[model samples]
Target chain A: MFFYLIDVFGTMAFAISGVLTAINKKMDPFGVFVIAFVTAVGGGTLRDVLIGRSPVGWMRDLNYVYVIIAGFFLAVIFRKKLDKLRTSLFFFDTIGLGVFTLIGLEKGLEINLHPVICVALGTMTACFGGVTRDILCNEIPVIFRKEIYATICILGGCVFFLLKALHVPDGLLYILTSGVIIATRLMAVVFKWSLPPLSRD
Target chain B: MFFYLIDVFGTMAFAISGVLTAINKKMDPFGVFVIAFVTAVGGGTLRDVLIGRSPVGWMRDLNYVYVIIAGFFLAVIFRKKLDKLRTSLFFFDTIGLGVFTLIGLEKGLEINLHPVICVALGTMTACFGGVTRDILCNEIPVIFRKEIYATICILGGCVFFLLKALHVPDGLLYILTSGVIIATRLMAVVFKWSLPPLSRD
Candidate 1:
């Protein structure tokens, strides 16, 4: 139940980020909503499809769609004041990154996918929504360019498996993994840490 | 046997297109290959996932991967002469679009999805490889902006259902649907037909 709420919060946060990107692109309302929907569900959808899970997470549960709708409305209504809420939004987004990574890792383990693939899935879940959002808005995905976003998720995945190898309790395993992800992300942003682009020459 | 050949041809064409696009973007060799791989299979992958097909088409078949590799090398070797082969390349691409659309439609029907959704799947399959390619290269998808590409696929899908309702035989149905898509796309390109953008308020 607690995890579900975090999933909802993460979906909402991703949707709002999509809304902001679409607005910046000067897209129509219909376009805005579509962007928000994809941004919220795209990552999980990709993960689900790759792992052979049918109908996907969002289709089976209309709550995700509703949450995206709610996020869209909230974003549009408070567009002017969003600047003031940046920190709060960032906080939620960081939490989302952690939770989503854990969810992906768990789903992968459930299907007995290789640990490397599971880590890739975890990073993908936490990052690909933003990647899709950027793509729709016609920009190179930030994560691919320089952000430490996906790296943090990858690190968290490693932590999850490490704890599991130690026979850590399931509950504690989840908490520690997410905690590592959330803290790293927060620190990365605070310290303005970024990956260096490969040299062109 | 013939349809499988067409599918392979289409995948190669899409991969070649991806190579061209990545080259234009001045991406590294690895980037070029990655773009080509995604452009070749991204649409079918997307379709497979949406409908709950597991393991995806490519993962189940090594031939697709091999074809993409062949296409990549062929494209790179012939890069300088590609301009002179524009017509040939476009012809292959058109054939791919038609064949891919039919494949998507058939897959959707196999799953007993509604006709409308099936048409959507078909259109998505026909155009989304190019869309994914453009997105990765940081450009707006040409189909979304103003191309008769997806529209032709949708029309072909409708024609497919219309024929089915008329009790068209399966073999003829496949040919006719793909024929309509291929012919209309050829005409659209020859006549420079394009969709007009919606007026900004």
Candidate 2:
């Protein structure tokens, strides 16, 4: 039940992020709504499709759709005041990154995928929504260039598997993995750490 | 057997198209290959996932991967002479569009999806590979802005169902649908036909 609430909040955060981006692009309201919907559900949809899970998470559960709609309206209504809520928004987005990675990991493990593939799936689930959003908006994905976003998810997945190998309790394993991802993300931002772009010239 | 050959030919054309785009971007060979692979199979992968087909087409068949590799190497080797092959390239690309749209339509019909949704799927399959290639190269998708590409697919899908209603034989239906799409695309290109961008001002 608690995890479900986190999932909802994460979806809302992702939707608002997409709304902000679409509005920045000066897209029509329809475009903004489409962006919000994809940002909230695209990653999970990709993961489900990869694993042959049909109807996808959002299609089966209308709660995700409702949450995205609510988030879209909230962001549009308070676009001007959104700056004031930046800190809270960042926190929720971080929480979303961690929780989404865990969900992907769980789904992969349920299917008995290789640990390496599971990690890749987890990182993809946590990152690809933003990737798809950026692609649609005609920009290089932030994770591909500037941010340490997907890196954090990959590391979190490693932590998850490492803990499982140690026979850690499932509840504690979830907590530690998410804690690692969230804290590292927060610290990375505070420290202004970023990867240098690859150069072969 | 004939349909499979068309599918392979289409995959090769899409991959080569991706290679050309990536080369224009001055991307590394790995980047070029990634773009080619996605351009070749991304649409079918998305379609398969949407309808719950597992393992995806490429994953289930090694031939798709081999064809993409062959296409990639062929494009790279002939990069300098590619300009002279423009007519040939365009012909193959049009063939790919028609074949891919029919493949998508057939898959959707297999699952008994709504006609409207099936048309959407067909158009998506026909156009999204290039959309993805453009996105990865940090450009707007041509189909979304400047082309009459997907329109051909949608119209062809409508033609397909219309003919089916008249009890067209299955083989004839395939040929007619692809014929409409291919011929229309050729005419659109020859006549420089394009959709006007939406204007709301």
Candidate 3:
């Protein structure tokens, strides 16, 4: 139940982020909804497809669609007040990332995929929405260049496995893994930690 | 057997286009291969996933990877001559669009999806590789803004359903549908046809 709440909220946060970006790009209503939907579910869709899960998570569940719609309208209506809520939005976004990573990792494990692939999936679920949104908006994906975002998800995935191997209880396991991801990301931002560019130029 | 050949050749052409774009962007070798592979198979992957087909087309077959690799090296070796082969490449690309559209439409039909959705899938399969490529290259997709590229695919898709409804023979249907797509694209280019921008400014 708790995980479900996290999933819904995280989806909304991601959708809002996508909606805001689309609006800023001056996209039409159709484009805005497309971006929002993709941002909220694109990562999980990719992961599920790769892992051979049919119909994907979102297609099977209608709540994601509802949340994305809500998030889009919230962004559109609250556009003027968004700048002032940047810090709070960041907090929600961070929590969403952590929650999403855990969800992805769990899904990967259920499918009996390799740990490495699971980690990759986790990171992808937490980051690929923004990547798709940026792509649709014709910009460089911020996660690919600007921050330690995906790296945090990878770390959280590692923590998840480590706890599982130690026979941690499910509830604690979820909290610890998500907490680690959130903390790692917060610290990365506070310290301005980032990956080096592939090209110096 | 014929469709298989078209698929392989189309994959190569798309990969070559991706390689050339990556080289133009001055990306490293790894990035080049990534872009090429995505450009070659990303659309099909998207279509398969959306339709609940898992392990996607490329993952189920190793030939795609091999073809992409071959196409990448070929492009690298022939970089200096590529500009001169622009007309030929354009022909291959147009043929690829038609072939891919047919494949996607057939897949959708096999799944018993709506005709309109089938046409959409066909268009996506024909155009999304370039969209993915352009996004990875950090640019607006040329298809979304420039020529009547996707428009041609949609027209071809409409023709396909029209012919199907008329009970066209299988071989002739395939040939005519692909021919229509190719001809429309070529004519659009020759006549400099394009869609109006959503934003006039």
Candidate 4:
């Protein structure tokens, strides 16, 4: 129940991020809505496809679409305030990474997938949409170029199963795993950390 | 055998088209290869997922990857000549559209999908990468804005079935359908034609 609440908030964060990207790209409202919708659900859709889930999440739940469209308008109406709170937006995105990863892991476990596959799914759920958005915006994704983003999601998924193996209390494990991803990503960005680029000959 | 040949040609054309988009976007060579591969195959990937095909085509056939990469370099080497030949590019793209629609219809029929769904898939196969390219390039897709591109594919598919029901010869039907799409698209371009805009308001 608690996880579901946090999951929706994460969706909101993702929606805002996509809307901002479209606005920055100078897209009209219809274009902004399209980008935001894709950014918020693109990862989830890909996961569902790989797992052969019928109907997909947003298709099954109208609320997901509603929330994304609402997020778009909220961002547009409050663009000035959001612009002033760039740090807050970053925090929101980090929180989103945690929420998406945990839920994705849970979904994989529910489906009785292998641990490795579940971790990969978790990483994809948290990262693919941002990658899509960045590519569409004509930039290399931040996950690939800067900050320790996807790695944090991967590590969180690892910690999730490790805690489960030790049979840690469920609620505590969820909170701990999410906290780890958020902290790792936020710290890496704050401290200007990054993965090494591929060697240039 | 002829159908397979047409399929390969369509795939090659779409891959080259994708690589050119990546070049225009100024992506790295690896990025160019990736975009080209996905652009060529993205619609088929979606169709496969929808129809529950296992592992997907490229996963089943690694040659698709090698072909895409080769196409990428071929584009790079001939970029200047290609840049000067928009008309010729349009010809290849139209040929690709005709072949892709046939492939999509065949795949759907093999899977026993509804005829409506098959036509939709045919339209998708012919138009989706172009739509994806425009989205990635941050422009409204020409499919949604310009001439009756997807419409031609749909019409050709309909014509194939119409001729089949009338006991048309197999070879003649194939040629006639492909010719219809190619002629439709070329006529639209040469005649300054377009679909009615949803609204300019």
Compare the candidates by lDDT and give the number of the best one: 2
Candidate 4 structure quality by residue, lDDT tens digits, B1-201 = 777666676777788887777667555554455567667877777777778884455545656656766777777678767777666767777888998887788789998888789989888877887777666555677678767888888899899889878999978887888999889889988898777877779
Which lDDT tens digits does candidate 1 get at residues B66-146?
A: 999999999999999999998999999999999999999999888777786688689778777887898888787766555
Q: Judge candidate 2 at residue B119 and give its lDDT.
A: 92
Clash pairs of candidate 3?
A: none
**Winner of 1 and 2 under DockQ:** 1
Model 1 chain A lowest lDDT segment of ten: A25-34
Candidate 4 matches the true fold with a TM-score of 0.60
lDDT of 2 by residue, B1-201 (tens): 999998899999999999888777666565576689889988988888778787566756778888998999999889888889989989999999999999999999999999899998998888888988888889878888988999999999999999999999999999999999999999999999999988998
TM-score of 3: 0.61
Candidates, DockQ:
0.19, 0.17, 0.16, 0.08
How displaced is residue A124 in candidate 3, in Å? 10
Where is the poorest 10-residue window by lDDT in model 3 chain B?
B192-201
lDDT of each: 0.87, 0.88, 0.85, 0.79
In model 4, what lDDT does residue A25 have?
92
The true-versus-predicted C-alpha distance at residue A53 of model 3, in Å, is 4.4
**Alpha carbon lDDT at A58, candidate 4:** 92
Tens digits of per-residue lDDT for model 3, A102-156: 8889888898899998999998888898898887888888888899888889999
> Residue B185 error for model 2, in Å?
21
Candidate with better TM-score, 2 vs 4:
2
Instruction: For candidate 3, give the docking quality class from DockQ.
Output: incorrect
lDDT of 2 at A42: 87
